[model samples]
Target: MLAPPSASPRSVPGLRVPGPRTEPAPGRGARAAYWARLLPLLAALACATRLPSFRWPLWSPDEGYLAVQARMLADGGELYETVVDRKPPLVPWLYAGAFTLFGDDSLLPLKLLALAAQLLTAVLLVSLARRRWGDGAGRTAGVLYLLISVGLNPEDAQAATFEVFMLPCTAAAMWCADRRRWGAAGAAVACAFLAKQTGGAVLLPVGWLLWRGGAARRDTGRLACGLGLPVLAAALLTTPTGFLFWTVTGSGAYASFTGSELHVLVRGLINAALLAAACAGILPPVVRVLRIARTGAAELWLWLASSVAAVLLGFHFFGHYYLQLMPPLALLGAAALQILPRERTVRALVASGCACAVFLAWGLLAPRPELAHATRLAQAVRADTGPRDRVLFWGMHPETYWLADRPPASRYLTAGLLTNYSGGRDGPQVGEKYAVEGAWPVFRREMRRDPPAVVVDDSRGKPFAPDRVPSLRRILSVGYAPVARVEGAVVYVRVGR
Candidate 1:
């Protein structure tokens, strides 16, 4: 035994001989560990880039309008009944929650919350990309999402709009569907719908996925239940009548004021194509996805199609409306990168990075005319009015109401009701006079019952037109006098109140 042990290692039941030491090969576990550490860092970086916009003044009137509604809700006001907006209740409620968690007065906290949602959406896109393709694709998808989302698209890129809020839920639904978790997918899609009514378009692809899977009937049933529950609960709480009338009927009226469908579609497609080309990284993936109709290819195509349909359906063609298309575009773009040679991919990524940098710089440095005007108006209003007093805007500027920290005199937040009544080229048809007249009585009643202390007439420096609504003009003449003029806005104070 001693002679044999001199040259050879002994093997025993419980012991083994050690050989030359070697490094362990990097496996899936190691890759997973690397991603686990990397994802958070990437997300933090993305969020950091948006810090400049935090204290930025209200640039979009829609955002300011939503903020006012949220503030009202936080102050124990009922949605739709007390504060009116045409959007679904969930967005206002979410804003209300943010205001409650932070203080209601400042917009910074709400902007921060929106930034958080943006980061989460980016992360979910990464995860979905990874599951569909691989780790490299996942990283690319997330980075692309961050770049495209924050680019200098103005209305969409800076504001806390419904499209910005709906992204995470949309991404989560796709991720869940990939995993065959039908119920979770349905629930996430429902959340998206709650965020924006157009988000219901996600159901088309999600339903297809459920139908193609095993246990189709049972899974479909689960999907339906998951999708229905929250909607049912929200409907019950809000009372379906008001919600339907506003979100559906009122929204139809709003859409009727949009550009012609042909013009809108052409403009939207051209703009979207230009945006995609500007980003550069997105086009290759879209091309690649189209060429290869793999197992999950149909789903991606469907998602893109549905998003386009949703955007065009509104007929508004606002830049933010195209935001619904970004997720699928990012995913397809990233996946396309995986098929390229290493050197070529590196070159492409570098080009994409440069483009993104340019866009980011533009977004951060660009001067916002609306924000500056809003700041001046807010300062003037704050100096003249008390917290208990109310202010009314006579034109389209709802941001003044928010910055001024004064409640609106009536439920008609925007001048849409008045503008619609006026019936210009882009306005409501001349035939809808009865409907427009019907809304005037309510506006008149509210304004007369609780008159505003300061009436800020923002009709481009013009005085209120006595001919359109003589009653309002009569009240303003009898009760108020010009106190301050800021920018093009003229502020009036109640006389001897």
Candidate 2:
């Protein structure tokens, strides 16, 4: 959460009698237009930081695979039926719909969507900052958010772009709710939920508004309707059979996924550190302190605390997850920036922010080349591997299932080498528990229950001793035989016809 703003004095409701108007300030309109023009250019310039091919291949193997899945879905097929993972349909639906409409799943549409959201978040930040603080603070906030990469990471390509698009809507709506503009608020909340499930969290602050007297009855109803309609749309979108792709399946786990401690630890450590630092930016206070703080602004402390809480829920600490609260948090940061007492402080913060931005850009783009190389694997598998093959990895998808632009059932593998997949031959590496407690047995049950044509794993990292019997190695050694081997990876085909 951005450090909470000190509260403002509550004003008694009143309607002032009409007063005489005064002449406009000398340079007001001109100055406003100049900023308006500069804002767009600055936003457009931000686009350069994210152009396709700029970073090449640093994408996680999973997201890249999603691109491939999106292509398959566009070609007319049930999703997850082929892709074999548990994730909401919104993203795939989004990717497939746009790809189908535009005729490509290139990074362009993703970038474009992210660009629009990024720009909107900036505009909303500018508006909110100006209203809450002053023009100086507003411009400063907008510029900082723009010039820095706190919310925007080119490395992730467009994974968290949903935050950009939906966040502004949520922020604007929350601001409107705070101002008693039910219509605007309703529209904003409704749009955010449609964009991402986590976005519905915006309702938390808006709900606080209702509790805190920030919203009127009419505004509340409008907000309900706005949020309700999108849900109705989703209900309409989901089919009876299309129910398995939830991020968390019916049980308390990641529906039926498993992965190694190494994979989990590597990703988790990096994400946790980043999120911890981001959270550090928001000074923590006890509930009583937040309630009593004279946060010279409206619900500043409350909102900041609430905003941070919003991000932490279901927070895997992924760098992109921070985008959920970043835009609004930017407003808080802007608010925080204004209260800076010294020029030296501002310079220090700004410089540090710039350095972080560079690191973020690298974090995002640096992996692009590796991700791009994984595409080669996809191509090789398609060309050499038989139709009855699945490309498995003891690790993350080199790019993403969707990125391969291939079919869902393409057997583009992601199961862990240590997992109990394929008669327990392939399972998460030896002692890994990251996804097992949540994902394993479900996947094992699925594989033992369903069974793909073959079991293939990269097995690139440290080898795991199969403590479980009926392992793939034993089964394959006795029955299935290795048909192909690439790098440190191996593809095992079930032995006899």
Candidate 3:
């Protein structure tokens, strides 16, 4: 009887009932997979496009100064004691490490390291976007991030600045925070801070996310410990007076000379628009997140807010500062890309690729006015000076020291300190009196004790201002003779000494 019942309609061969149906794997479309694989290649190509710039003879003074300091460190000079600058130690330390691994004189290795950091940042952005949004968002975000980073306005984008070195750590911190890895996040944030003082701005958003994610009190404590330990170590290593004076008090004084707040804000907005145009896909996502106000959306908003704060902190809106805003904007842009139809998404991606190619081509072909003169100057200096010789640049240019492979006679790398000391056209009594009175004497004493073999003065073919540093003028007049002129710089060599 049981067998007869089993042979009924349910057991019929052609009319068998179906079991639970399995849905297709999400985002498994051929298009999604193609984009996912293409993202890294695009990012790598973007980085490779900048490689030829490594051989460029001209560089920003800041970059040149950093390179020399790093070389000094690699040559066994102590920080603060022998190498002094207003920047935190991490960047120089990174440079020192690079020099240790590669040749100290060549900029190629340092540039390669920067490119690697840039690529790592793009990868981290993809991981973060994917975890928070989806696969499509991740691929789009990664490609957009690369395009925007390299396509930033030319003013400060080409130089390997502090922001460039700090971005990977900042992106890593955000990725770790997204995953609820509080301790790792804290370490990453600390690394970012070590890279640049303004990098501490990341803490506000990261801390909020930790609290919102219901992290245990003990977990939060671990984060604090992780952050505090490196700071404490750095404090112990660097002299308190020097570190505090330069990074804190002196930094404030430096900020006063940047520019007017209104000027900075207007320039910053223009640069922001250029950045947005480079990756326009971010606009829709930004609008959508504002409308929905979900947790992920709120996190992105916090990131953008914090980035804005960081950019505006000094009221000095260098184009490089806008690099701080790129990660958040790229993520939002990627999300927007994800919302488009598949065909439209492919078209948009192809358009972005074309735009990036154009930007790269333009950057490569643009004329650098400093290149020919700088190369001549470096050649002249190298030809005249021996390996152990020290050179001093009396005016602003720092690139000479790096290019000629000569050590600085004094710790004041740029004329900025002297410029700030001597009241210029900016205003009366606006210069730092302490630097004029206090540091000037030290500079004079240093020059007297260890006078350079060569002194390059950049007064634009005119004598330097006497009021700026009368002692420097006296020293140059006493022992040096004008030897050669290159690129509006008067090169002086010791005559009788």
How would you encode candidate 1's per-residue C-alpha lDDT over 368-398 as one tens digit per residue? 8877887788788888889878888876667
List runs of model 2 lying over 4 Å from the truth: 1-35, 48-53, 79-87, 150-166, 240-251, 255-300, 341-349, 360-373, 385-395, 398-405, 410-413, 416-455, 459-480, 493-497
TM-score of each: 0.85, 0.72, 0.84
lDDT of 3 by residue, 32-144 (tens): 66656866696566566555446464346667878888877777777766677776778888878877888776777777777877888888888877665556667777777
Strongest candidate by TM-score: 1
- The predictions' CA RMSDs to the true structure, in order, are 11.3, 7.2, 10.2
User: Who wins the lDDT comparison?
Assistant: 1
Superior candidate under TM-score, 1 versus 3 = 1
lDDT of 2 by residue, 336-429 (tens): 5454433622663566455445655565545444555456555655664454444343345535333433332333244432343321223443
Among residues 3 or more apart in sequence or in different chains, the pairs in candidate 1 whose N, CA or C atoms overlap within 3 Å are none
Ordered list by TM-score, greatest first: 1, 3, 2
Which portions of model 3 miss their true places by more than 4 Å? Answer: 1-43, 55-58, 257-270, 288-295, 340-344, 347-351, 421-438, 461-467
Tell me the lDDT of model 3 at 206. Answer: 86
lDDT of 3 at 190: 85
